[model samples]
Target: MARKMLIDGEVAAVADGGHYDYDLFVIGAGSGGVRGSRTAASFGAKVAICELPFHPISSEWLGGHGGTCVIRGCVPKKILVYGASFRGEFEDSKNFGWEINGDINFNWKTLLENKTKEIVRLNGVYQRILTSAGVTMIEGAGSLVDAHTVEVSQPDGSKQRYTAKHILIATGSRAQRVNIPGKDLAITSDEALSLEELPKRAVILGGGYIAVEFASIWRGMGAEVDLFYRRDLPLRFVINFRESLLLLIL
Candidate 1:
């Protein structure tokens, strides 16, 4: 006999009502999954969210909380940019009657360590948020076995099956590299955020916002940056090449 229940303002039929584990099972703990699960739980639905182990550099088996935008995408990138921007600030302060003495050197190790500490702290904060929301947080990868069944694989290769009336998939997206020769030697944005040392020279590919942002970041930190783009104009033709004003003239 099929059992029916109301979920998210909709009626859903289940094969076994008494045997089901949760009302809502969410895959991926990224922003979407977290928001969806929290919302569902707020509506009095039993929710369980699954995600991989915490890692700054993500892969199929390891992804931290808060997904790409919070973890590797925006948060870390902005931190680096802010750290690099200090160079301009220090130089500008000299013109404002602030006497600057000695060579102003940026320490890559110190910045990387502090950024990592902040990220790890935020990861714990996200977990606490889920705990407070009453959502079950399972550390693993989730896959759909059926319309109402989800299979979660833990880090130790063990798996658990949970049946829910509704399931949400929000694993998020991964960065793709250009299929060129020696592509493996190139690093993606994820690795760029946690680099141990700043490179003296950097050649960035693409003409998008990310590429331009990184070029500015490195250039601000005193690196020789060369950006390559296929389009006639950089940044989708919104900003001209010469008048882009990447270099900070202090």
Candidate 2:
């Protein structure tokens, strides 16, 4: 007589109904998680998303709502790149019949401060977007308790558990330093983005997009950069623009 349904490959009775706390529980508040939660919530499903508190530098338990791309990765990197590119622009302006006065100085501190303010503003924007979509936002690190349950570890050392019909994990990724001598002394991209002072000279490792981007960013800002990679050439896999990219790096 009671309704029957399949959950986790087992037949379960749905006669009681309204058993779970939410229709959906998202484990991360990154771009992907936020989008997914919003879309689901728009469809009238009760949704909840949990993420760590806001911080520029990410850890296992300190990522912001906008996630890596907005908080520390792409958005911040592009801002620095634009700030650095001004030096070249100023020089090129001379060719365009523009007379420049005294010495043009780049202040790393000012750029860093403004970049952080923009990131913080974007983080809040993402939170508001989620709220507007009728999604519940929880501040904490989320872990899976079971197939349909999530346990969030709050910042104040409190744990809250919730049940949902479905769970999604979009925790994103973090930067990892290579294992070598003085590895501890080396900083990852996370710390690099929020440095107190800009390095007069920088030594970068690897040949990936991030490595090359940083090298260019620092070089544009008037830093002495030495890039080292164990490859025949940087961006070897980028067959299309490899030649042009190589020239840019050099």
Candidate 3:
């Protein structure tokens, strides 16, 4: 069998005992999975970690390198948020006695374009982190073939089994869209970061931090935001309001 000298992959130097093949097999190449693999490898434990192809919009199917953070979650979300926050920063600059220009326009397409590029860059960086750590990085989805063994499905429909003393799952959380009739029209926080056009009338429903933050962001970007929560707060009906200032919940 021909193997590259610099190959940090599953095909290892076969030993007579094959006991040192892999001490750990990380099922998902997400944050916790990759971290665990690298840490174990660093401490003289053999490791192999697998992940799906790079995806701009991550689902269960097409999740990419760097896990949810780079492909669809934190990296893209933060980039868009940073891009959107400038609108407010511009407003605050005017109040700070700075002679800012008139009617600063927020280009959703441009911000989305830049965010996509930044997210891809971060994905590559994460790949480097895993590879440079001497942890064998496999590109595919892993399944439990047995108790101590896993079957990895490659991009070309090829299957290979890996055995390890320990198996780990680190596939991070995924964003879920609402299950309604018109749910297809609405995008989750993941797809929202890559919107082609700014929503003219944005309606957000939920009491979570993502919902609140997105509402604030869209409002800042000049969208007519109608935010709804399960419970509504009354401003004027204050029974000693200064005690715990829970203001403007929705």
My TM-score estimates for the predictions, one after another, are 0.90, 0.91, 0.80
Preferred candidate (lDDT higher): 1 or 3: 1
| lDDT tens digits by residue: candidate 3, 1-250 | 0122114444344345554347678877777887787777666666788888887877655777777776777667777677778877877887889997666666788887888888788778878888887889887878887667888887678998888766787877777777879988887887777677888888886756577668767887888987676555322244356224464332
Q: Per the 3 Å backbone cut-off, how many clashing residue pairs does candidate 2 have?
A: 0
lDDT of 2 by residue, 13-99 (tens): 233664778778998888899999988777667789999999999987799999999999999999999998898999999999999
| lDDT score for candidate 3 against the true structure | 0.72
Provide the RMSD of all predictions against the true structure, rounded to 1 decimal: 3.7, 4.2, 6.4
Q: Say which prediction, candidate 1 or candidate 2, comes out ahead on lDDT.
A: 2
The 10-residue segment of model 2 with minimum total lDDT is 1-10
Over 4 Å off in model 1, which ranges?
A: 1-13, 237-250
Best model number under TM-score: 2
In model 1, what are the clashing residue pairs, if there are any? none
Off by over 4 Å in 2: 1-18, 247-250
Selected candidate, larger TM-score, 2 vs 3: 2
CA shift of 133, model 3, Å: 1.3
